[model samples]
Target: MLDRIDATSITTIQLYNQPFIRAFEMTPSLPTFVPATQLPLAIDNGRLVLQDMLGVGAYGSVYRAIDTQTHQTYAVKSLNKAGLNSRQCAFQNHEAQLHAKVSGHPNIVTLHKVVEENDCLYMVLDCGMEGDLFYTITERGGFVGNTMAIKTIFSQIASAVLHCHSRGVYHRDLKPENIIMFGRSVKLVDFGLATTEPVSSEFGCGSTFYLSPECQGGFIESVKSYDSAANDVWSLGIILINLTFGRNPWKQACPRDETFSAYAQHNDFLQTILPMSTELNEIVKGAFCLNPKKRITLSELARRVQACRFFTTPEFPSEASVVSAATAASQASFSTTMSGVYPTSNLHGPDDKEDSGVDLQSMA
Candidate 1:
């Protein structure tokens, strides 16, 4: 189902199990700019008519747009250039380049084109009419008993990540908010924080709940670099938990978080606190392993996910027991040497705590 975009140069990259064709050429040089304060009703010389606002962010908003030429619909992400600093501008360019590299994958969002003008930058992408995974999960109250659905959705997401990795792209900010859906099909989006570097010293560069302990840093005092690929794997494990339960295992992955501390010390801690099957627990354990070198690779993870049939225990944990385990774990001794991070309010949907100083550079 890999759809190749029409491009001039075609190259192949070695994937974990096989070779993958990396199509899509580097985009043409950015076009000349025309300055203006507000979004244009028509862009690309009236080819696209901007419609309703789909969502809004600090620097920009996404709008539903229609191509007058093809009569096709798209989600246009419009960023206000006046609000972005030099570094932010560079990151925006980098995001487009990295996203283009991984665009052809079936499970990843297609970046149709990049348009710049009138004090703003616009990215025309496939519209996800069903909204994001966060809203979908919240509406359904998690995929706890839906094993088949979980398998299908998670596998697609994994495939998308694998595809990105095959292209030397690491999506540092991997979370439910960045995962959109068109019916049951998943599309990974937002590559502003993504990097081509296999390893990065950019600690605290992702959402708190999804970041690995290494990425969170502050444990050993001295600076340390982390494997970005492994960081992505760790985020996937958290995402799996969110899909199985309606909630996150913890607020953050750092040792300072009581819930995460309990899981780190005891192998069966997750089961003690939640209704998770041993089979699914093993997968989470592999992904959450403290040692980045030993964390399961994306290929191995995809294989395990495909093989796993059960994701939750038949009997759910009692409310009292869940509370008791959380209470006891609150007293567990964990490294107190960690940097202060804003609490990640909820995993399922957006909350008022978004601007509460997350450890990432930009949550675009």
Candidate 2:
């Protein structure tokens, strides 16, 4: 279960320019939620019985459940009925409809069904027996030297994103934690922050680590508008980095952060720290381009990910190289200037939901 952002932290704003619908924010907040034990046990009559609590998010809680009729296991995500406002209800409906739209891809978690009881809205999802990519990466200490593994995992992820885009849905949050793994295969989950619009000005909507500079809006010089597809591409690029090195590039994608400021100012700053190959470096650079318009397309990004061979050089970066890169980046003046600062952002890692421990035998 991906932890949904709190309702209080998010400001209700208009998402699009034409229709002018009020958009719900998926930003983080303090954990103020109804415990799973407090919710009703029986769902869809007495067919589904809720078991242990899997995890809790902002709007709801996910529980390991069993279908008594079929004797099959499932995870049920239940949204709290009493807490939902009109905007939150809109968000819930939008999430269900949009997620269902993009559900058939092999690498995407399947939405089995949606059941709206009088007290809760339940989403029956595929049980990820092996937890998420974040846990895998942490356990293995990253995929630094394993090009084959990285390529296989990333290709599936990119393929899933491409499929979503084709279906007119854009998953605003694309971090590793939102991806559930079943052995070698993975399924993308958590459409809580997704939008049907191709472009959005909903700045600071996603996790801080995977946000693009344009999305990390806090400066007068920052682009007021951003391409949603390009922003997703930027997050994919960060995931690529995580897959390769097992760590985030920076705390935030703004000039205020020293590491990000260096990368933004110097072209070679990433290579200086990480031993990225030329081809991989080019992909990263393209994905992280300051201008959203110039950012690489999702299809092209997938193509490049498949084409690239080595993600890193055979050797680690020399101490001297690191110093030189840092010095050069520090000397260059900050090209993007700042005016106002963003509200203090929560620095939490990607969604850390526990595995349901139920192996899904069905793919379709």
Candidate 3:
């Protein structure tokens, strides 16, 4: 789904996976959806009037809706029997179950409720106006120019992931698109790939570039059992690099990864890539280390990130830049392709312009 709505009038034909559509201009107002009809998507009680289509994927669509009773807005995800397999539909139900298990974490999105009927599924989630981290990164160029802000954002993410792990859960799908922002405050969303078991399945999962070295589910014939917590930490490291550098360090993990190997051969690798402090350098090394056994745990990583000077720095221009970008993101429309929401996605895409720089070898 795309945001092609007219803010002045809340009535617009919902477009699905359209290209070159202009972003929606939204303001605080009630929705005027097309006259009640039995569509694949719709909800009841409190007149849950579905508004703008926030985002759409291969399996389903997320819409902006309003609870007429409270006049409060929410992000509603609809799963229907069009263009989706049974497994994909199951993933949606799995996500709803996971959200129910862990809903009180401050940094994670709260699942308001779920509806079942019309041979479809509707899930109500907290509506975030500021869009997602991917858009913010694009608008800001990269976080390498804003080290303090990067630390600040990463610290929050580390804390959130740590909280998830503490509750015996793991967000297997940790990526920029899944992390929505509301100014400096951030919330983790989209738990379609989340799991409670150490290794949910032998097969691969999550976005390719963000997958842990051990969890190359798609590329490898048989993936070694992976600790979900460690997988999350590795993905978090990739996110830090992606946000700060605006590019992935390599297509895969190291020794095999040429770019990472080159960096490993150097002593000032972390600082060489970006102007990171010595303490921060150590943290980066711990997170990005080729050996997962030596990598820092979520708790340790969160503690270090929260205590870091860059993370604690307040009122800095670099930090303020994120707020500014988020405000812009709030106005612009956000999109999610069918590919993005899938379990196995091409780690390399058009947006990852530097994907060519890394050597993507056979995981087997």
Q: State TM-scores per candidate.
A: 0.76, 0.76, 0.70
Which segments of model 1 are wrong by more than 4 Å?
A: 1-39, 83-86, 218-223, 317-364
**In candidate 3, what are the lDDT values of residues 90-193, reduced to their tens digit?**
76688789877777777888888889765668878888776566655544333544556676788778778878887777888787767777656678887766
Give the worst 10-residue stretch by lDDT in candidate 2.
Answer: 355-364
Q: Name the TM-score of candidate 2.
A: 0.76
**For model 1, what is the alpha-carbon lDDT of residue 232?**
96
Model 1 lDDT per residue over 129-217, tens place? 65556544543333545567677888999999999999999999887767876555788888867899998998876676678888977
> The CA-based lDDT of model 3 is what?
0.58
Candidate 2 local distance difference test against the native: 0.65
- Candidate 3: count of backbone clashes, pairs at least 3 residues apart or interchain: 2
* Model 1, C-alpha of 42: deviation from truth (Å): 1.4
Give me the displacement of residue 338 in model 3, in angstroms: 23
Which has the better lDDT: candidate 2, or candidate 3?
Answer: 2
* Two-way TM-score contest, 2 vs 3, winner: 2
For candidate 2, lDDT tens digit of each residue in 1-364? 1223322221111110112110112211111234558756778888988765655545566766789999887867777667668896877778788889999889998889999986678888877655566645543333545677788889999999999988888887888767776666778887877888887878877766677877766322756667778889999998898777655665567655555666666656677666678889999998888887888888888889889977877674342242334324422421222111101111122453222110111100
lDDT of 1 at 166: 90
- True-vs-predicted CA distance for residue 308, candidate 3, Å: 3.6
